[model samples]
Target: MANFNDSNVLSSTFYLTGIPGYEAAHCWISIPFCLLYLIGIVGNSTILHIIRTDSSLHEPMYYFLAMLSLTDMGMSLSTLPTVLRIFWFDANEMTFDACVTQMFFIHSLSLMESAVLLAMAFDRYVAICNPLRYATILTSRRIIHIGLVLLCRSTVLLPPLLIHLLWYPFCDSHKLSHSFCLQQDMIRLACADTTFNRMYGLALVIFLWGVDSLGIIMSYIFILRAMLSIASREERLKALNTCASHICAVLILYVPMIGLSMIHRFAKHSPPLVHILMANIYLLVPPVLNPIIYSVKTKQIRRRILQLLAPQRCFSTFK
Candidate 1:
């Protein structure tokens, strides 16, 4: 008899036990998801490496991009593995402890990403609206302090939140309807009353991510209006173009996020299978698209990416 505590035994046990019901044909879905996950890792890693190695990108905007890439990496890691398992292994059976861990990370990283967006918006506002004092206002020390503060604040949410999840009683059908463990899906599995989880989750989303996104939107509106009043066409174009990448990023990040919240809240009656797909989109799409948005819209990143990858191609030196 193999002891469950034995490392190799446990690995073999949970791996093949796959999701409870939908194990068949999960392979088809796993292939595409695996591809997307690979892209997310490579893209985000490139941004992090380039930002760190290239001294030229050591400004406030790229500093925010570094944080964004870090959060994107965190966000993808939190949800993607479970999703891949669900797709390939039929592994819908998450123990209560594992479920809570997943929820904590997914929520924490989601919050961190939102905070990074707000910081990016502030950076853009300073760069476009007040170019002269940009360095003075957003010094390296200041940026690092803000990053630490954001990390600390977002992290503090987890201990209390996970404790809240543990308060719930588990149902017999511990299988999560969603491919991944979501706060909503976990709450739905509660045998005891789950009134608190729903209310608490909604409240946090509203006050935290909701407020941050609202502020970002307002910042851009003011920026655009201010751009209109500028005298020189060159200056105006420069200001707007600088913000172009930031705006695209905000839209791609927030739109699906808000949609996911709405779907969880309002579309409660949808089939679990449908909700599973939605959750995948919510978690996966942003990271997959974010690097593309930055690479395409941000001139500096585009040039750096080209330079960084240029060595891989075979360019001939003519005699």
Candidate 2:
């Protein structure tokens, strides 16, 4: 409740917490967190490498999967350093500028992931509903354009908001509940009336993530309609099966996202561990699991990964 527009406040730094009230367990917690980071980085990187080398995977769906993998890699890399620092080394201090940068990357990557998932859903719809024209619809040039648009859309919207944040006066404790910086967490510490910040945050969520989710749901509706028209049940299942990995990816991303949002909004009274756990799940689960899901559900990716692991066993057929 003190005045924070003074010079001292301008230079103030925040200290991030690692599972509040569990300092003794921070080291223990770091093990699983580090493992998740390793899986996410290696798994997504392997996906990109396989996609790049496998000419057979040079299609729209795989192209979108590659984009998703790239986004997953970005998300993991963006958060890994701060997360490990907090849990492993107890280095929780973050300067304001650095915090803003981290927040921008985390939020921007999340929006980009939402856009990529929507794009993937559209790819599935085109592949299933109109296979004959799928190639024409999502050509390589068009896919590149879509990726650029998604990236640009996220890249452009956040800088102005972040700039606004950099100037806000902080009147509250500079301690954040999680290992990573987040716009919502940081803004709540501002002494200034953050009506605009709160509203813009809500609008951004609704316009970007909300619309992307709606687009995905609509695409699935059309896909379902197209599948139902097929007379053969097995054929319908096969067509739908193609989207299984994507469906799982969407669930993994959005389910935790929704849970995190709800926890921030309505569960302030709940135990700090609940919020910390949800935040970790949101930051860690998607990147770690997305590649695994795709490799398991998609036959081509699975076979290619297997071939990569055991080349001699597959050389007879793959070669």
Candidate 3:
């Protein structure tokens, strides 16, 4: 064990924990993880393909959805190697730089997803609340600009946290709580003061997620108000229905995120399994479910998916 007192103890290797106390069941745990990865990759890829192939989906809403899928796929790919290594080959050791890189991609992609969701909420709000100005407000150039802004935001905000981390000398217990590197998990292994890291991380979360969440809520408030002004109940319901998929996607991402945050903040003494499970859910569930939710809730995407899946039947019916 490297001495915690020694400030010069810069550990080069970090061990990723699979499922604590379930070393014997690592193989079994990997089964579900593999399935989740498969579903996430295929589902998000299908959503992207559908959006690309259909000209009708060339609008701002589908463009944002495509961005969301790309973010999900990036997050999944970031963790896939380490996760499989730990579970399949029992290889848990990660080099310091490699771990930091993985942490960067995972968290950055997460922030990107949050931004995409916020943009989707704004898209719906404009469509329902200010239909006349929707096209002008969310032009293709503006959407592209939004995408670039989101990418820059996600990429730029994380390096300070990581660069500070690179200087911290890790203690003997360099074992990360999850199969992938997390800034929160990585900080706990440091021998030096992680106060800056923790505080800055919290601030980033609050700034990005908190502000995004507030924006989403405000958008929905306006949307509901707009819906109420419509004289026809059917029109109101129709307008509200358009938001269902985005709402589900938001919940899928935020609920697990909030749960994981609570677990890390307040339930530090919780079982390792609890932390691991919550982390997995936080990372994996959104990617797998978002595509399904959109396919089921959005008629255009659903019909496109169905037509893709059953071309002959769709063709026959159309004929």
Candidate 4:
């Protein structure tokens, strides 16, 4: 075990682990991961392109959805290189600074996703609960301000906590149990007392994930309440339908996150494959599914995609 007082800690390289008991299957496993990475990247890029080209998607709801797509792309890119390297070439080594950098982006982008989801929920609430004021409430300027605030909130609060990792002296067993770095998994490698790390991590989780989740739930509750006041069944259904994609997005984002947290904190003695599977699902599922869900559920986006795929057909139909 190394200590904080030691100089060697600054120069150490940490080893990353893949599916622990299935080293022989790494190449095979990389296949599915590669597919997911491609889908997430291309899908998110397509969403961004469509949003930018279509002037009709200039509203607050679509703008927030665009932010969500961007964050998902960011999260996938942050982990993709290291994950592929570990699976493809058996290269699992990362320097201290690199690990810290990965951890910061991975976790911060995750928090940003949560914040964006909350913003989307707010957009829905305004559209449903106060339809008359939706435009006034979520102006383009306000939306831009919200995005900047979310960006600042996610990027700013993390570094002060993560900077402490550099000060800790690590143990000889610097193996992190994933293809990429996580503050939780990496902090355990430190030989010094990680009481502060553990506590601060807990606070961070509660503050970010906990608060964002609660806000989303509250927004939905208000949405449901507003829907109930609408006497017509079809109108109520239509309103609820608008929220379905966002509801699916929220579920996909949070369910795996909760499972990963449970496995990390409570299932310490569980199989390594279980942890690895949950972690990968946590990282991979949302990026791949979010775009698909939105494209299917949101008619405007779906129509835009078709127009992009078959522009002559779109032009002929318009004629």
- What TM-score against the true fold does each predicted structure earn? 0.87, 0.96, 0.96, 0.96
Candidate 3 per-residue C-alpha lDDT over 62-109 given as tens digits, one digit per residue, 9 for 90 to 100? 999999999999888998999999888999999888988999999999
Off by over 4 Å in 1: 1-23, 312-319
lDDT of 2 at 2: 42
Cα lDDT, model 1, residue 37:
88
Model 4: lDDT to the true structure: 0.91
Candidate 4: C-alpha RMSD to true structure equals: 1.8
Lowest-scoring 10 consecutive residues by lDDT in candidate 3?
Answer: 1-10
Candidate 3: segments with Cα more than 4 A from true spot:
1-10
| Local accuracy of candidate 1 as per-residue lDDT tens digits, 78-115 | 87777777676655566656766777888888888888
Ten-residue stretch with the least lDDT total in model 1: 8-17
- lDDT of model 3 at position 145: 98
* Candidate 2 Cα RMSD after full superposition onto the native fold (Å): 1.8
TM-score of the candidate numbered 4? 0.96
What is the model-wide C-alpha lDDT for candidate 2?
0.89
Residue pairs with colliding backbones in model 4 are none
